[model samples]
Target: MDFFNSALGKNITFVRPEYFIITGFVGIPNMKYYYIFLFFVYFVSVLGNGAVMALIFLDHNLRTPKYIAVFNLAFVDLLGNTVLVPKVLDIFLFNHPFISYNDCLTFLFFCYTCLCMQSLNLVALSYDRLIAIIFPLHYQVKVTHRSMLTLIASFWAFVVTVNLIIAGLLTRLSFCKSVVINSYFCDHGQIYRLACNDNTPNLVFGRFLIFLILWLPMVFIFLSYSYIVYTLSKIATFHERVKAFKTCTAHLSLVAIYFIPIVITFTMSANIHPNARIINLSLTSIFPPMLNPIIYVLQTQEIKVSLRKILKTRMQTKVMAKKVIIM
Candidate 1:
C-alpha cells in the first residue's frame, strides 16, 4: 500500500477534461445527483444480468445454442461490472479512491481483457444466431455443446494471451504519479498516457489489437447479420420472419452496445479537437454499461420472464417460512 499512502495518492487529478466533464454535460443533465443515478443503473444492471445468468444456469428448458450464447453474454457483463462498479462506489462513498500502481495496472489489464472478451462473446453469440438462422439444418450438429465449450475455452485462452502480451509491454514503462484516474475505473488509455517512456509502440500495437478485437469482429458480424436478414427475407410467412427476427433481437441489441461506443471513442481518442474530446471519451466510459441491462431486459423475453420467476420464488419461499413459524 506504499503507493496508496504516497503523496501522489492524496491528490486527485482529473486527467484531462475528457474524463468527467462531458459526462456532466450530456448525461442526464436534469439530475442533481449524478452518482445516485449511476447507482441505480448499476443496481439494475446487476439484478437484470444476474437474473439472466441464473435462468441460464437453473432452467434446463432454456439451455439451447441461442440461450447459451446469451448466458455467455451475461457472464461477460457480470464480470466486467463486478470489476468496475464496486471500486466506483468505494471512491464515491469512502474517499478511499487510491489504487496502488500495481493494482491499477492489473485492473487495467483485466478491464481490457473483459472488454475484449465481451466483444468476442458478442461475436460468438451473433455467429450462433447466424448459423441458427441461415443454416438451420446443421444448427444442432454444428453448435453442439462440446463445440461451444471448446469455443468458450479457446476464446478465454486467446484473450488471456492478449492481456499478458499487453501487460508485459506495459510493465516496461514507468509511472511517476498516483494521479487519481478521472474516470471511475482504471481504463487503459488514461493509464497509458501516464507512462513516462515512449508509448508509440504501445499506441500502435494497442490500436492494432483493438482493430482485431473490435472492428474485425464488427465486420464479420455485419456480414453474418446481413446474410441472416437476407435468408429471413426468403421466408414466405410473416410469423416465421418475425420469429427469426425475435431470435436475433437480443444479440443485435448487444452488438449495438458492445461496438458503438468503442468505435466512437477509438476513432477519436487521438488528436481530437479540444472541444470534442470530452464528449468522445465519455461515450466510452459512461454510456454503454449504463444502458446495457436495459437493452438486455427489453430485448430478451426470457430475461423478463426469468426475473419474474425469481422474484416470485423468493416471495413464495418467504411466505412458506412464515406459515411454518406460525404453525
Candidate 2:
C-alpha cells in the first residue's frame, strides 16, 4: 500500500485485496478426471523437457546454433510447466483457490512470461530454419553461437521488461469489486476486469500483449515459411528440395502444436461455452511443452542419433562394471 501510494502519487488511493479466489473449473463436471490428466501431462513434460536439455548439454555434437534454440525451447517448456501445473492442481483439484494479491501477480508474471517466450522461441527457430534453407552457403557465418545467444538474450530482456510493466500496472489497480478470477491461473484479462478503478492502461496493454506475443509471432512464422517455400522452389533437383524442406518438419510440428489451439480458442471465445473455453486454453498451455521434445526426438535425425550414442555408451559402461565385478 505504501509503495503503491508513493509510486502512484498521493492523489490516487488504491484499494488492494488480501487474496483472490480462482474459480476457473468450479462449474465443470467431473473435473477429477481432468486433474488426473493434468498430472500425467506435467509428469511427461518434466521428463521429456529435462531429457532434451540434458542431451543438448552433454552431447558436444549438438552444440550448434539450431540446438541452442532447441535447448532454450526445452528450458522454457520445462519452466512453463513447472510454474503452471502444480499450482493449477492445487487450486482446482485440492479446492484451494485463494491466492494472495502479490502472489497472484507473480503467478501472472511467470505464466505470461513463459507463454510469451514460447512463441518467441518458435520465432527464433523459424529464423534458424529460414537461414539454414534460404541461405545455406552463409549459414555458418550468419548463425553463429554468439549471434544465437544474442538473439535469445534480446528476446528475454524484451519479454521480461514487458511482463514487469504488466505486473506493475496491475499493482496500481484498485480491486474493490469481485476478487474471483475466472481463469485457472491469474490471467491478466480477468484480473484487470476485477479492478474498480480505471483499468484503461491494463486494457490497452492487454491488447498490445496479444499482438506482441501471439499475432506478431504467428505472422513472422507464416512469412518465414512462405519465404522458405519460395527458396526451396528454386532448387535444381526435387530430392534436394525435399531434403532441405525436411529439416523444418520438427519446427513446423512444434509451431502447429503451440499456435493452433490458441488460435482456435481465441477465435471462438465468444461462441464457445465458458467451461469449454477454459479447458481449451488450459490444454493449449500444457500440451506443447510435453509434446515439443517428443516431436524433436521422433522427427529430427540428429537428436535420435545422439540419443542412441549416449545410450550405447552407458550400456557399455554398465557391462564393463559387471565384468569387473565378476572377475
Candidate 3:
C-alpha cells in the first residue's frame, strides 16, 4: 500500500498522490498569451455581469422575472469564473502548479455548484420566456417577483445538494496509484482516472449526474421552446413573430453554448488528443460566463436605453459642475 505519505504537522491522514500537476497549456511557447486570454475572459465576465447587475438593481422598471433570471445568471457567471480562472492565471503566471488534494476537492465543489446553478437558472429563464410567450396576459400574475425569487432560492438549494452529493462520492474513493492529471485544473474525469480501485461506481454516478444536471434541463428547455414556437405560430402578425424570435435568440444561444459543448466534449473524449481536449475544456469554462451578459443584458433594448440614460445624466452633471467651477 504505497500511500503518498505527507507529514503536515498534526492535521495528517492516509492520503496518496499528495499533489497533482496542473499542465494547462504547458510547453506552449510564449505562455503570456494564455495569461492574457484568461485575464480578458475573467475581466470581461466580471465587468459585464457586474454592470448588468447594477443596472438591474438601479432600474426598477427592469425588475421582472426575465431580468431576474439574467441577474442570477450573471451572478453565477461572476462566481464560477472567478473561482476557476484566477487559479488558471496563478498556474501560468505565478508558476504554481501543485494543487493539494484537499484544495482540489474544495475547488471542484464550488466550481460544479456554480455550473449546476447556471444550468438550472437557464432552465428557469426558458420557463420565464415560455410563460411570457404562451400566456402573455397572465404573465404578470404567473411569474411574479415572489415566484421568481422562490424559484431562484429553490435552484440554489437543488444545485448545492447535487454538488455536495457528487463531491462526497468523489472524496470516498482511494487514489493509491497514478496521480498525474493530464490537463488544466482539477477536472473530475482527469482526477478520477488516478484512482487505483474500480471506478465504475464513480463513472456511472457521473454519467447519471449528467443526465440529471444537463440532459434533463436541456430537454426541458427544448420542450419549452417547442411550445413557444407553437404558440408564436398562432400569432397573426409578422412583427410579433419577429419580436418573439429576437427575444428567444439570446436564450437559445445560451442554450447552445451550455449544452452543445457537453455533448461534443464527451463524444470527442474517446478519440481526441489530450491537448485538444485541454483547450476544449478550458474554453468551455471561459465562454458562457463571458458571453452571457452581452447576449442577455447589453444587447437588449431596455438595458441599452438605461445605460445611455445613465451615461447622459453623468455627462450632464459633469458639465454643470464645470460651469459652477468656472463661476
Candidate 4:
C-alpha cells in the first residue's frame, strides 16, 4: 500500500490493472484514434439527449402525460451522461488520473443519484404506459397533470433520500487499501470493495437496497405490462389497440436497451474478469445516452412534427420582424 504513496505511485496515478481495456485503448500504439472516438461519442450523446430534453420542453403540444414521462426519461438520461461522461472525457485528456478522496465521494454520489433516477423513471413510465393503454378512460382523471407532477416530485425526492442514506453510510468508512478503481466512474458497489473496514453491513444493506431499487421495479414493470396486454386484448377496436401498442414500442425499446446492459454490467462486476469493467460500463452508460434520445425522436411522430412546427414558426416570426424593421 505504501507503494501507492511513493513517487512511483504518483507517476502511476490510475488505480487499475495494466490490462484494463481503457489502459490498452488509451495507452496503446495509436492513442489518437481512441481519444478522438471517445470525444466524438461523448459529443453525440450530450447533444442528442440535450436536444431531446429541449424539444420536449419547447413543444407546447407535447405537454401530455405520455410525452411528459418521455421528457423525464430524457432528463434522467442526460443527468446520467453528465455525471459519468465528463470525468471519462477528462481521463482521456490526462495521463496521471488521480481523483481526490472528496472527488471520489462526489462522483459516487452523482453516479448513484443519476442511476436511481433512471431506474425510477423507468418504473414511472411503466406505470404510465399501463394506465394509458389499459385504462384510457381513467388515465385522464388518474394521471392528471397534477398527479404526474406529484409522482415525478416524489420519485426524485425518494431517490435522493435513498442516495443520501447510502452516501452517509459510506462517509464513515475509511479507505486504507489502494484506491485504484477499475471502472471509469465511482460506482458505489465498486467503491465499497476498496474500503478497509468491515463491509458486511454495507454489503447486506447495499444488496437489500439493490434488490429494492433495481429488481422490485423490474418486477412491477413486467407485471404491469402483462396486465396491460391482457386488457388490450379485451378492447374491441383493433385500430385503436394497434395505435396504443405503437406508443409502447418506444418505451419498450428504451427499457430493453437500458435494462439489458445494466443487468450485464451488474453481473460482470459481480463475478467476471475485472478487466472488462470498462467495457461493461461503456456498454451500459456510454451507448444508452446516445441511443435513448434517438429512439424517442424517431419512434414518436408527434415530437418530430412539433419540432418542425416550432422551427417554422420561429423562422416565420423572424422574417416578419425583419420586414417590419426594413419598412
Give lDDT for model 2: 0.94
Residues 1-327 of candidate 4: C-alpha lDDT, one tens digit per residue: 453335223443323322112232243355566556667767887888888878878887888876777788777777877777677767656654667666766777787787777777888888888888777789888887787778988988987887777877666554655566666666666666766655566678789878977898889988988898888788789987787789788878888987888787777676865546555666576677678888877988887797788889999999999999999
Segments of candidate 4 deviating more than 4 angstroms? 1-34, 268-272, 318-327
| Tens digit of per-residue lDDT, candidate 3, span 1-327 | 233233222344434567778776787677688789889989999999999899898888888888898899999999999998998888768888888988887888888888888899999889898988888899999999899999999999987887777777666566766666777778777777777555676798788878988899988998998898888899899898999878778889898898798789978888997777787878887889999888866457888888888889899999999999999
Q: Which rank order by TM-score, best down to worst?
A: 2, 3, 4, 1
lDDT per residue as tens, model 1, 88-167: 55655545656666676677777778788888888888778888888889899999877777787788899989888787
Q: Output the better candidate (1/4) by lDDT.
A: 4
lDDT on C-alpha atoms for all candidate structures: 0.69, 0.94, 0.82, 0.73
Model 2: how far is 250 from its true place, Å? 0.3
Model 2 stretches with alpha carbons more than 4 Å out: 1-13
Q: How many clashes in candidate 1? A: 0
lDDT (Cα, 0-100) at 258 in candidate 3: 80
